[model samples]
Target chain A: MINSEHTAIMLIAVPLLGAFTTAVFGRVSSSLRNIWVLAILASTELLAVLLGVNVLEKGINVYALGASFPTLTSPEGFPVRIILEVDAMNALISLIACTITLIVVVYCLGFMRESRVLDKAYTLILLLLTGMLGLTLTGDLFNLFVFFEVVSISSAALIAFYVHRGQSLEAAFKYMVISATGALILLFAVAIIYSQYNLLSMAALAASIKYTFLDEVALVLLISAFLLKAGSVPAHMWKPDAYGEAPAPVAVMLLTSALVSLYVLFRITYTVFNPVTPTIGWTLALLGVLSIFLGVSMALIQTKLNRLIAYSAIAEIGFILLGVGSSLTQSPHTSKVGFNALSGGLFHILNDVLDLGLLFLAAGAIYYLTRENNMNRLGGLGKTHPVLGVFFLIGLLAVSGLPPFNGFASKLMIYESVYFFNPLFAIIGILGSILMAAVYVKAFYSVFLGVFPPQELGQIPKSMLAAMGVLALLILVIGLYPATVIKYLITPAADALINPGDYIGGVL
Target chain B: MALKWRYQRMLANIAYITVVVLIGLGLYAIVFKQNLIKIVMGVHIMGSGVNLFLISLGYREGGVAPIYTLAPKLEMVLPTPQALTLTSIVINLAVVALMLSFVMFIYCRYNSIDSQDRRLRG
Candidate 1:
């Protein structure tokens, strides 16, 4: 029997196995493929939850494949076997990833019966989930790059799902260009680090090259590569168009799963580049500030519901960057900033995943009734689709950081921390929140509170609604008792982040 | 030890400068080109130039070729940079292929790949 440590790796591998079997089953009946895929996700999530509980009971778990378990060196000297590591931070992230997979599966079950290539879509979805899980759990930097490419390819393919449309195709093209470029740059950075340090293990690299010129270049390059992946400021140009034109469920998935990259960005910044350069912190803060302003401004102009949601996500991401940035600063950085900021950011990460996921699903529901994403055409939906509208309202409230929602807790943590950094920056962040509130209010009024649109007086799939319900419940739960979450999960992650010694020590 | 080491450094410097100039010119073409195909070609040029520069980073004055002989005492070139350039070339090839496929898809869909034509016609 596999132990608790290996369970985390299996959670990721199971879905990749499912994706493979689903593709093979595509030769069989489509219903069989769908059923098996759903079964895989449901089982994976159940296993993940069980494993997470076990890990919480018995501290962080580590697994090494082949040669030996935990610190095995290959006889070949090449060290070819993949090593998978799971800490408390990874366990929580795994739960979140699997939960999102579960919700997305339920959502897709009834969401796309009419599409001809539903089997392919399901396979891609499973593969994407597997890639994300692998990313969050992988130990080595080279494997991280490989997992990154896998994620990118699947995401890009999903973006181009409806190839008949000009908008989707164009968006996919731009996404392809940007993502391919980002991957190459990431590969270059990885190669540079490997050549300079001669160690592929992230922990080893962290240990060796403690303070040197090569380390500086590698750290800057690593930060740049992650920032590109995270879609901060300059690299954020592709996000709006790609998310806007994607089919609604995929957009929901995008909003939810995309936080993985930011999580990775922070992980690398903290672990690999221990005591990150002050310049990098200030770069994030600067880009974050710019993104906050630009994203809100862009959101104000968008008439399309998906584009508005996409832009709002950009603004929220800026807040996360701010929190992460200010964490390392604050006049003699404390254990609190890393803990507080990442805890807030990580909590907000899940919040955005659920709240914004529900909101996008709500947008999808609206589009189902009327086959347009334009907000000008949608009105008085609450009267006709009360359940959907209410959930969306919950999402809007939660997403804009209002009271009694998950976003508020996370946002408050960051807001207080940033205030610690600079009271003026905190004020600016608050102003951004207020702008977001106004935007959502306008969104609510335009979509749900006005005279009924004849086009939207209809029904949507119950499956999608159920998915939104799951997300909405999560939003409320996380919001109400964030401290419990911090105690169990964020504290460990914060410890992991600041203490590079474990990672370095383990590798060398 | 006294064989004018300054001359080798001078050679390296010239090679580096020329590589940079080539890359810069290619980038300028990419940024300034009006035609989409030209821009694609420009990117290819820039990529190739960068790859060459990376390969040159591995070269040493009197190093033997990267082939292994049973005999010892032959200093080998830096294999890391060569490996890096090889990876870059492959990745660039993939990018170029995908980009061309996209251009074809666009042309098939809209009957033109030119941004100017599409915008003006629209």
Candidate 2:
């Protein structure tokens, strides 16, 4: 057995190595490849859970890449090698990425079984998982940018998996252009920082950052690039196209990747550029409100099933940005309300993943059964597949923050905290939730409860149903016991973001 | 002495200004051009500009290659930015190849490489 200390690097290496090995196995037999892929995913998820537990117990774990010992962050009194740091915050995000990837791979086994490009799809999926894991785990700024490109390249390839459809190819092209441009801008910013300080480690840079003129420019470039990648309003034109056209399982991973981009944004703002001015916070808050309004309003008019859900996902990102943005506005001396807002934001990430993952899976199932995604043609599905109806209804309610669901718990935290910060912010958030609920209700009525006769639909594979069931169960559990999750998980992650001193000290 | 100093400063300024122009022209092509292939070339151009900026950050007036085994004892240019530029170049290569392939498929399906064609709209 590998020592527990090496778990951090293993989390990334396992899937990276597994991806190529699976391809070689694919040439031998499909069943062999399936088993190999499943085993690798299962092990990766297990490793993530273990790493999360370790971080919870040990506070923060830092591993220097070329040092004699893994924990030796600074050999010459300064960090000279690449590092992998797992604070409570990173561990939480990595756990979410691992769980979602594992579940989606299981769903893929059923969804893509009939396709000719199954091996290539699986390879790209594992590569994407590696990128996400590396993105969350790395402590070096340059390493983070490399993994960001990795996620973008693999996801763009996967989005165009259906080569027969021109729309998928177009969507993939647009996503590639946006991601390439955004990443190049990010590289330019990184270059500026390196030229200023000759340092690439994030924690070290945070300790020494003086917020000089060039640093401020770098910050602007960094935030804009990450915001574009995170699919915030004004730069979100590529999101719906990518998410709507990609295969269903791949769409779920893409949404998670966007959330990871948001995580990077928060990390940079809170840690690297600590004590940022309130103007930046207000800018984020303004963008959040715009994203909520625009995402839901556009979702209401969407005639395609996956496209509607993609818009709703954007709205969900709004809630998180609002919560964290409000928290940031009170930085350098955060109040109790600010703390609650940050926790609420982190908790909403968990709720959003479960809610949106289930919804996208259901959309995939619909496409699988009827071979159609147009709302005008998909009717009376509930009458034929009551099980799928229940699953989607759960997703819709949770996404809209309806009661007895996890979304309500987290949104309540955000609303109450932001209300204390400023009543107007809370009012806009509540109004957005109301509009989102109406939008999903209309989608539900159209797809599941229409005035059309029942059509002959194929049976949804057991693996697909099983995937949806797991997410639905998690939502209900977290919803019913919000306090338990908030205490053990959300608080630590929020605290990690609130206090950058501990993170800097861990590395330096 | 002043003339030499001014000449060096002028060169540095030219390098920075060239970087800005390259990035600006690339952005113009991406935003205003209609042809898919041109947009892809624009992305590559933007990448080249960033890479050039990175390389310029590491330049020394009289420096040796950053190899430890070399005999020269003169100042070596900052090796880190050069390394970063190489990595960026490789990533850009992958992105350009993937994007051009996507453009090929788009053309094959739509019989047009024009991004303005309505069928590409989602």
Candidate 3:
């Protein structure tokens, strides 16, 4: 067995090396490539789970690169080397990323079986996984920026996988431009922080940050850049285009990528800049409100299936932001309401990934059958694929925060806690959930319920069904056992956010 | 002695101003340019501006290069920013190549590189 100290780095390196190895195998035989890819993903998933368990059990796990021992974070009380820190929050997000990537790869096995670029697609997917895992685990600011670029570049390449479609190319261009700009802005912020302190490790920076004018400038830049990358409204135009045009499994990965950006946003705000001013908190809260309103309103009007789902994904991001932002407003003060809001936000991230992943997979199944994206052109799919229709319904209910599903459990937390923050915010959130229900119901009706002339449709591969089933099942389990998940996973994650001392102490 | 300090400060201000101008021009190009190639150029310019700013942060007056082999009994500039700038430059190169390739595909399909082309819009 690999030593537990090495799991964090292995979670990143295995896939980075596996990506090219898979490519080489791809050149020999496709089946061999598939097997190799699966092995890599499974091992990486195992590593993530191991890391998560270790962190949960023993507190923050720090692995320093180039150190004589992996656990040596700071040599002689100075942290100069690149470090990988797995606190509860990082572990939670990494587990989510890994599990979702595994499911998507399974789905891709069936979804892309007939595509010519299957080999290249798998390579890019592995690379994308490496990037996501690295983004979540790194403890250094520069390392974070590097992984940020990695995620952006790989996902942008995957977004254009369907090169024959001009729109895919167009969407990829737009995504690349936005991501490159966001990343450069992030680099600028890192440079600003480095210039001030000459320290690159997040723990050291957080410990030493004086909140000067330059620090404030760096803070603003970091927030804006990440918010832009996270696809919040007013900076969300690239999302619909990219998600609507990319292959379905890739779209799910893209959503996770955006969620990682959201994770980083919270990490920087709460940890690096602890006790952030109320003004920053208000800025985040207001943006969250705007994203909720604008995202759903825009989603309601979208005619394309994936684009509509993409807009709703933006709204889901808003809910998480609202919870985190409201909690931030009460910084340096651990109130029950703020803690509950933060827990809700963290819990919502898991629910969002499962719920949105299910919805996108179902949409892909329909598109696979019908070769149509416009909802108007799709009908009677439910009659043909009843299981898929039920899965879609599960996704629809969950995404709209209907009861007996995971979305409701988390959204309720957001609503209840944020209501205490501001009643008006909760009111708007409730209204947005209502409108979201309407949007998805309309989508369900148009895509699955309506009658159309029967036509021959190919069967959705068992792998695809299995993937969707896994997500639906997870959603149900979480919905049924919300308290259990919150007790074990989310509360610690939220605690990690509020208390940066543990993170700093683990390193310094 | 006061004049020397003033001159050094002015030089620093001028360097910072150049960085700002480069970034501004890049943003303008990205936001305003119709041609996809020009927008990509804009991204490159913006990235260059950031890289320049990062490198400037490491500059030290009358300092030797930050190389272990080149022994000098003098101050060495901060090496981290230079390493970071190099990484940023490589990332920008990959991004530009990807963008330009996408532009090539867009042009091939649409016969135009205009980002405002209707088919590319929502």
Off by over 4 Å in 2: A69-79, A452-454, B1-8, B120-122
Q: What local distance difference test score does each model get?
A: 0.74, 0.91, 0.91
TM for candidate 2 is 0.97
Instruction: Write one digit per residue (lDDT tens) for candidate 2, span A103-180.
Output: 998898889889989889999999999999998989898998899999999999999989899999999999999999
Poorly placed runs, candidate 3 (over 4 Å): A69-79, B1-8
Give model 1's docking category. Answer: acceptable
lDDT of 1 by residue, A1-508 (tens): 4565568768888899998889788788887887898889987888777777776677556667664655666442445445666666677777888888788778877677678878778888888888888888888776777677677767777887887776676676667655655564565566567656656677766666565776677667667766666676877877888888888778766665567878778777877777776777767877777778888888888899988988888888888888777775532255665568756766677777787788888887887778878888878888888998889899999988998888898899988877766787778888888898889889989999898787525567788888889888888887788788778777777666666676556545
Interface RMSD measured for model 3: 0.9
Lowest lDDT 10-residue stretch of candidate 2 chain A:
A70-79
lDDT for position A391 in model 3: 99
CAPRI category for model 2: medium
Selected candidate, larger lDDT, 2 vs 3: 3
Q: TM-scores across all candidates?
A: 0.89, 0.97, 0.97
Report the C-alpha lDDT of model 3 over A1-508, residue by residue, as the tens digit: 8899889999999999999898799889999999999999999999988998999899999998878653454423444478888999999999999999999999998999999888789889989999999999999999888999999999999999989999999899999999999998999899889988989889988999999999999999999899889998769889999999999999999999999999999999999999899888878888889999998999999999999999999899989988899999999796999999999999999999999999999999998988899998889888888999999999999999988999999999999999998999999999999999999999999998878637899899999999999999999999899999999999999999999999999887
Best by lDDT: 3
